[model samples]
Target: MARGRSLSGPLFLLLGLAAGITVGRRWLDVVEVRGGSMAPFLLPGDRLLVEAHSYESRRPRPGELVLAADPRTPGRELIKRVASIDDAASAAELRGDAPDSSTDSREFGAIPLSAIRWRAVFRYWPPQRAGLLGPGH
Candidate 1:
């Protein structure tokens, strides 16, 4: 009876950990800002917690920060803000906080909404600047 109880505890812990990882992968992701495109609001090296499920239920709104697949580079992603959304067309125009430094909608044109995979919800790294990110930030 003692041996069985000990094994059960570890087994349950392992199962719980596996479940957490699966759920995390499906709904949550962390992305690190890589360039000055989103400067002032999100600088390079800022780590953001992004959620994928939100967009599944509702369309993205203007001014929201999002992680999208770079149209110019396959397999690469870029972080930008939603400048406008066209529900009828299923596309969104994205832009950088610093327009002069960003290669966004201006260069590649509005991207398909399907290309946008995650919405940034919080800045968790660079402790001093960490906080919940919103449309205004």
Candidate 2:
């Protein structure tokens, strides 16, 4: 007895796409912490997993580590701690600022949901520190 089968063009294409999406969503896209902007928690060379999802799925709370687009450097991304927001009360209490305000003082200003690439889910590498890196609070 002999059994043989070959994938057709359409089936092969579909399989390829499914595989691509799975890999892209799970592991293809990743970022590494490069600055002390998010110090005391994340350090340079820390690999982070980035998955494309609804920006509004979860709100960025204070002290949470996030990967955002650097407004000053178009097309570039940065990793920083979410310290404040555009709210007067939140800023004033957490940071102290008025509405329509900016949180981080770096070249980039407030990061709209669109500017956010991904939230730091977990810290990889260095062996010693392997776990979630959410806000201190």
Encode model 1's per-residue lDDT on 30-55: one tens digit a residue.
67889898889899999877888899
lDDT of candidates 1 onward, in order: 0.82, 0.53
Worst 10 residues of 1 by lDDT: 1-10
Error of 2 at 19 (Å): 10
Tens-digit lDDT string for candidate 2 (46-117)? 776555453457556666666666667788676666666665432211221222233354433456654654
Global lDDT for candidate 1?
Answer: 0.82
lDDT of predicted model 2:
0.53
> Where is the poorest 10-residue window by lDDT in model 2?
90-99
For each of the candidates, give the backbone clash count.
Answer: 0, 2
List the candidates' TM-scores in order: 0.82, 0.60
